[model samples]
Target: MNWYRFSDLAIDDDEISMLRRVHIYVCSSKDLEPESAGGTEIGKMLFHLYRQGVRSELGLIRMVTEGEPPPAAEAE
Candidate 1:
């Protein structure tokens, strides 16, 4: 669902789908608590993606929205 757009990196269709699922899980699970489960899970996923070099427009948007820095640029 195209959750984010930044510069030239667009999160792939699959990642968008995953984000939608994450959103749904956060929205529906009252037991989990948004801050604890939802926030942590999403944060972990974002960090993992950043480390794996999966930087994308969607990911960058997520970072900014969540008050995070964009992934580091590759070394020259």
Candidate 2:
């Protein structure tokens, strides 16, 4: 399942900004898993948070850490 670790939630301006610039790369792509089908659960979570509102524009982006280049079909 998709759970948030401390590092996953931390803020690093340089990396964060770089991620926003490439938001489309991650946020636009969707891979439905067994737990949450239909739409991207993470995307839905972010959308919910956006609906709640934030001080600045929050963009969702993803990166490759290990496994496949697209970073899919694995367990964390």
Candidate 3:
């Protein structure tokens, strides 16, 4: 079985720009209206999660695009 990597996709500049925008939006949203109470905390949490997820995805992309892949294991 072959594993798919983000680098395998032919992602265009527009898609990359959109991902960057989403990352920035989530990061900014985490700090927005910190003075507010109630649902503000929940919103921050969600935004934090989003930021983490995006960062993870970006890391994967970087790894696949810029780093050498590990040798694939031989099938049993």
Candidate 4:
């Protein structure tokens, strides 16, 4: 799969708009909680994704398929 970085999306207005919508959806969703283990995992993924400005689709795939723990200091 081709991964899109922030720099690539920065030049495209349409991609930026799509990313904004994905961000809004994540923030507004009530199902994801920070207290639960799964929720915490998702939270960590979001944190890293935000810092790196990863593509929304790629982030979603990673969140579902990997669930890799992020750096403690960064996640906190």
Clashing residue pairs in candidate 3 are none
Q: State the displacement of the C-alpha of residue 3, model 4, in Å, after optimal TM-score superposition.
A: 18
Give the runs in model 2 whose Cα sits over 4 Å from its true position.
Answer: 1-23, 28-39, 58-76
lDDT of each: 0.54, 0.43, 0.47, 0.54
Give stretches of model 1 more than 4 Å off.
1-34, 59-76
lDDT tens readout by residue for model 1, 4-46:
4473465567866665555445334323554576666755665
Residue clash pairs of candidate 4:
none
**Which portions of model 3 show Cα errors greater than 4 Å?**
3-8, 32-76
* Residue clash pairs of candidate 2: none
**C-alpha RMSD by candidate, in order:** 12.8, 12.4, 17.0, 11.8
Top-TM-score candidate index: 4
lDDT of 3 by residue, 22-69 (tens): 444433434434345633554454345444453354543342234545
What stretches of model 4 exceed 4 Å from their correct place? 1-9, 31-53, 56-58, 61-76
Tell me which of candidates 2 and 3 scores higher on lDDT.
3
Candidate 4 on 5-71: residue-level lDDT in tens?
Answer: 7775453677646545544444335344445675566556665675565656656545544654432
lDDT of 4 at 37: 70
- The alpha-carbon deviation from the true structure for residue 35 of candidate 2, after best TM-score superposition, in angstroms, is 15
**Native-referenced Cα lDDT, model 2:** 0.43
